[model samples]
Target: MAKPQVRYVCQSCGSIQSKWMGQCPDCQGWNTLEQEASQAATPFANKHNLRGGGRRIELASLSSEIEPAPRRPTGMTEFDRVLGGGLVPGCAVLIGGDPGIGKSTILLQAAARIADNGGSVVYISGEEAVDQVRLRADRLGVAQSPVQLGAGTAVRDILTTLESQPAPTLLVIDSIQTLYSDQLEAAPGTVSQVRAASHELIRYAKTSGASLVLVGHVTKDGQIAGPRVLEHMVDTVLYFEGERSHAFRILRAVKNRFGGTDEIGVFEMQEKGLAEVTNPSALFLTDRDRPVAGSVVFAGVEGTRPVLVEMQALVVRVPSGATPRRAVVGWDSSRLSMVLAVLEARCGLAFSGHEVYLNVAGGLRIGEPAADMAVAAALVSALLDRPMPNDLVAYGEIALSGEIRPVSQSAARLKEAAKLGFTRAFVPPRGNSGREIATVEFPTLAALVDHLTDGL
Candidate 1:
């Protein structure tokens, strides 16, 4: 028999080393190496077949008629929105977020809803005791729902207890990092343990035809805490994001096998729990009837949903000795700088001695470049102290050559803006996209600047 040896492993990048070191060579993280059992073959000799020992699998044709996968609705519209309608049977979902981001709270409420809808659900928490989860359920007013709860960290024990019963409709594992397999000598939350436990849990879901949801802790960089392969092993990966001080939360889907990616679910936290915000566009726009300088409504699209959000800008003169500052809230700071430079070089609008600040109203983050024209409008409006018409909306991409470019889904943007009672829209020059509102096209950045400052 061969004896097991120990080796050092980098927890940050999942790199294995022959010996321990103060710093990891792969990720350059200090003091992140941990000792684990080595899988080297010594004198151990267990002979088996050199090849072929599994059952033959049957193949199916693409044209064959097949029943579609059934969806289990948890009765939460916002939750279902992100999952692309509802949860599919045998789907494995990985939800990651920062500490105290309400990941656990939302999952508990979901499990209770599923149970109330006549579906059997099991919630196994490795991080909290059964009583603790029950207390939270009671606080959320869902204690009456018949959801089977268990608290354990041993993967073997968990699988064993689940073997004697029928397959549940839904299974939740609170934190896969806390689960440790007896097959591996490594401690819980290590890379090897997380990978092995997730594999087993996902396999169970596949074989039993039950929906599985796994909660994951995030690293300081906001990524899930595990080997990158852990994310690849799941069918869906969701991220819960928001500022801790804010009441609104955004549940975004980065990867989904059964649905579209980049889809988002908006929720508001309150004393009752998380409530769904059905009309996110209306929630993001504030006092749209009253015109204000440096504030313009941007018709933007988040995934498949069209959203109208206010873009606010401020430009002020700084002292000769003080450096001008460029502060941003929810939009990219570099994009703002580019807009400022274009206004200066292309439209002759001086911003060198002026401090600039930009913010996207509501807690939502804007990533699309289609916001460039709206941002430019806000900057011009602010610098000239000219309030834009309350009935107008704008969206287009700007280039360094001072040209306005057409954005995708222009029709949707215009439709959303008009639905919000806006009568005018500024879009890039393109073939007429049929719209319900009055469209004012901008051929270049200079042209829009002329319109803003001509009579300021």
Candidate 2:
């Protein structure tokens, strides 16, 4: 028998070190290092090393015919969309979000629907009691479903009970942090325990061809709380995002092996449960009863969907010698600074003593750079006290050299804006449509500035 070697590992990043340190050198996270056992090296045998003959392995061509992995629909279109149409068999999904952001609510609803649709579902809660889960199920109107429920913390006990029952179509673990394997001396949620527990459960899921859903806890910085390897081990990773002041939640897929990544599914939080938002653009648009300065509609793409969101800007004069502050919400502040620099350097504008604030309405964050033109237009409109047309929308990317770049899915953007009763659009040069809506194409950011400041 040989003694196992001890190694220190960072819980946040899974970086191993020979000795412990107060701060992790890799991730710079403080107080995250934990002790774990390193397996001893196996002894070599003369007979095994001398053996030459071995079994041959089979190989397959790239064009070989085989049946595709079957997918089971969770009965919710929004959930299915984030999982890439449907949940593939043996797929492991990890979903993380802010506390009280409805991570459990949505999963419970989906589990009930799967049970109702003649599929077996077993929901195991490690944090909440069985009765507490039942109360939530009743509130979500899913208590009548035939879904088996249990509350436990030990991974060994959970696997033991699951081994006796027939393989279920779907298995949900409320959280991975709460399960601790008996084989390890480390506590639950530690690096070694979490890794070992996840590996064991995932191995079982693969052997049984069952889809596994793991709800993950998020840190204060909004990242999943665990070793980085947890995300890599899973087939798909999802982030449930929402503003506390907002009513809607965005389920985004950052990684998916079976489906398209960068896809988003919209859901609105209500009393009953999470309701799918079929037309999210309508909810993000502002009321057009009266045209207001510093407000412009931006035609943007969320995943494959064309969404119209309102962009607002406010420019105020700052006292001399005071550094002008730039505050932005729901959009990138660095990008806003770049747009402002182009406006001042290329468009002959003076914003030295003016404070700038920009916001994307509806609490929906806009990451696509296509909204650059709209943001620029709104800033200029606010600075000049000129209101843009209520029926006008903008979509284009602006470069530092004062050029307006064309974005992808032009037709999709224009069609969505026109359908929402926008009669005019300001987009990048070319890709115009034959619709009744008039389109003004800006070849450069200077041209956009000229139109917004001089032509207005």
Task: Give lDDT tens digits, candidate 2, residues 117-213.
Answer: 9999999999999999999999999999999999998988999999999999999999999999999999999989889989998998999988999
Choose the strongest candidate by TM-score. 2
lDDT of 1 at 335: 94
Residue 340 of model 1: what lDDT? Answer: 93
**Residue 310 of model 2: what lDDT?**
97
Model 2 spans > 4 angstroms off: 1-57, 434-436
Q: List the residue pairs that clash in candidate 1.
A: none
Off by over 4 Å in 1: 1-67, 431-435
For model 2, where is the 10-residue window of minimal lDDT? 41-50
What is the model-wide C-alpha lDDT for candidate 1? 0.91
